[model samples]
Target: MNFRNPVRRALVAALGALTVLGASSLHAQEIKERNLRFAFSLAKEHPLGVGAQKFADAVAQKSGGKMKVTLFPNAVLGSDPQNLSAVRGGTLDFTSMATGLVASIDKRFMVFDLPFLFNDAKEAYAIADGPVGKGLLDDLSAHGVIGLGIWDLGFRNMTNSKRPITKAEDLQGLKIRVIASPIFIDLFTTLGANPVPMTFGEVYGALESKAIDGQDNPVAVIESAKFAEVQKYLSLTRHVYTGMPFMMSKKTWDSMSDAERNVIRAAAEEAKQEERKVTAAKEGQSVETLKKSMQVNEVSPAEVARLREKVQPVTDKFSKEVGDATFQQVSAELARLRTASK
Candidate 1:
């Protein structure tokens, strides 16, 4: 009211400063100190483990050291199914597992487990990062989890103590361990092998005890899990491209503020990219390393085509389960990518 007076001007300036300070205080309050746990079944040196650490570090940095994430590698928490339950129930905050395990919650995810679905990591990445993958992730909200993004696990290959799998017939009568998922069981069964559904944590012991003759996984996984010690053959089957869906408990997500959620989303994305890079870099190296202890061979292109034909019935059955719309959408996307690449 007394703008001409110096005293009044000083009083107005003090009020303005107080308003700004109050706003800053409220902004700071939006991000509270939080500690979270992220568990997986891989060794600490695995790309997923490295990415988890990076995610934790990024969260701490982005939250100005108000947030922290502890990593639980080597399935110390439990198997993938158990961890999935804990995350959904809010007992655990974060976890990442093969999409095949996710198929138990929603069969549409089985699309990723289809044999010979992707020609290479590039094609797989395109689909995983595209609209189709986003839709599948968004659907997870109904299941009490928040899907962050798809992290790469490279391609699945066959390994066994019995013999080198040069052709589809080689898998005949050999007992092989597979993810406890319908698609995997069907895939192996269609290939003439007796597929024994089992959890990843149980595979090594089973192989060592001769409970199962062999198992299949990415070269990175085979090498990291030290399967070379117990298994004799590694076939570069590249049958399925596995993607790890990084997820958080919906209960935990609901408890976070908008600022906190943003931090989580950004950190997850960074970790996803880092994991992919590390996985790609180690894949070739892992294959070379495994050769020293295990007989290694690549399935010929003609034989892979034959193997693909053998599994077509299995694919057709699951495509129905995954729904025509979802299957077609992915097929169209893959077609576009192939055409563009040419």
Candidate 2:
């Protein structure tokens, strides 16, 4: 502690600084220069597109331009389900897809597809980003994909070229285009509609050709895909809360060094929040925009009650399918989150 020992003090400080700089240099060297691809079904101007850009920017910053991610929007790499398959087979790098689309690979993902499970985005996030969500993500390792994080896809409402759907019975006899998940098929079928399993790429044409009478998606999707041009009614059923998981292929993830992985994880985490905000902000505007082109109807609370009651059987069936313990725990978590948020 003697200041008079200038030579010794200067040596010590220099050594300490060198040690820190060396560590930083090593970390920086750990990131290998690589370009990557991220695909999603939403249009580039959509929130998912914004999120992908945010993630790509963060990766660039973290890797010092050594890593780059190109965005593929509007199912150019194929539909969500197809891209998911490619990711699993190690042919694709990353994609953000609805949990229901992922549920086709593992039924557990469908647990989020339960109708009326969450009352709002806040409650949904509380359940999804917490332990229940972690477990769901963790289980993906066995399926050859790395589950990065889940973002909000907002609540799904029904849109159709047919009459407006204000009650569960209105869903009856309508051939609705649904994601290629069993739960969607069952959900629509139980409510009396014939569910036609189709990918996002086929929806607009299907609606245009009258191959399907209606489809369900968040308002953002409806607007981005220009569904209003082909469909007449936009029913605010808010039947299912959708979850989007940013995922990477296990092959791509396994090849990355720990430093690279850390940077990507941090970037994804940062981008996730911004993506949710973008999606939420666009939702209101999207709805208003659609109203200008289509007959938009808000399902009455009494009718929503009826829809939930009708879908209870579908819920019970999926609970058993996804395992009673998981279903019960998720329900319990949502209850806790709802009460706490209140």
Candidate 3:
């Protein structure tokens, strides 16, 4: 062999081997270790809490131990409004919160809580997973947050110590504790009831002391918080289809690689599906549990129709307040979903 040729061949072989080894190591490093902390307002037994756990599990699994999620439930970190501020400030990485608090940031989010806007959970999911929902998420980018997907908090029902609410008139004069959302206040006020806007942590005490005569929440939430003990009547108003947004800090999200972002998005979508299934099952069971402890009243279709008619103007008012264009878009998308589902 020519000595120069041998030397050149040996150098080429070593360089090729090093290149291969470097690529392999880079591939391995692509799946680097990261820990994401998430906070929520509900306790571990609630559906939101359950969904958060599922999300954390899925992220860890899909990322192959590269990404880990730690959950802070029961408002361990703080209330919904507080955590939302924290996330925006970059002090917190991620959170799932009631859209009512989010509505304060962008009034368009109130569309989700508009009374009777969604006929059912499927309809709600369709709208949230479609263009209107994506637009709403894009809108959040300006507020220092990014909305990943909607997590089911289930449909809201009414509970009161005064009496069972059968129709719009029945709600009159009842001091109903509501989340600090303008839509809720407008809806309840329109129906002739006193809407007392307050924090979630304060609701139980308010109800117990008769500081507020009643409050609205999903069946699972009422049961989980033992509201049945303070509340004498449970009315299946299903007034609003409630859901939470899985949101992340804009700073944290921008720092993530495209691959990492994809993993988190897929995990959130998966968790949303799981949450819907569990919430549907839990609602009925929670009702049964509440029936044993308090009087459970099912409002007939006729009564629900009456209530809907009474609240229609409230929706119109909200549309005007939120801007007519955004409301029309939301309504049109929701209509398309309903027609398709039917």
In terms of lDDT, the best-performing candidate is 1
**Cα deviation in Å at residue 140, candidate 1?**
0.6
The TM-scores, one per candidate, come to 0.94, 0.96, 0.90
Positional deviation of residue 312's Cα in model 3 after best superposition, in angstroms: 1.5
- Candidate 2 lDDT over 249-329, as tens digits, reads 999999999999998999999999999999889999999999999999999999999889988998888889988878888
Global Cα lDDT for candidate 1: 0.92
**Model 1 clash tally, residue pairs:** 0
The C-alpha local distance difference test score for the whole of candidate 2 amounts to: 0.90
Clashing pairs in 3: none
Task: Note the clash tally of each candidate.
Answer: 0, 0, 0
Task: Kindly report the root-mean-square deviation of model 1 from the true structure over all alpha carbons.
Answer: 2.4
lDDT of 3 by residue, 1-342 (tens): 453798888988898999999986775566668888898877788888888889999999988878999999878888889999999989898898777778899988888888888888888887788887888888898999989888888889999999888878888899999899989998999999999998887888898899999999999999988899899999998989887988999998888877788888899889888888889999889998999999998999998888889899988888787788778887887777667767
Query: Model 1 over residues 45-112: C-alpha lDDT tens digits?
Result: 88888899989999998888888999999999999999999999999999999999998898999898
Q: lDDT of all predictions, in order shown? A: 0.92, 0.90, 0.87
Best candidate, TM-score = 2
**RMSD (Å) of each candidate, 1 decimal:** 2.4, 1.5, 3.9
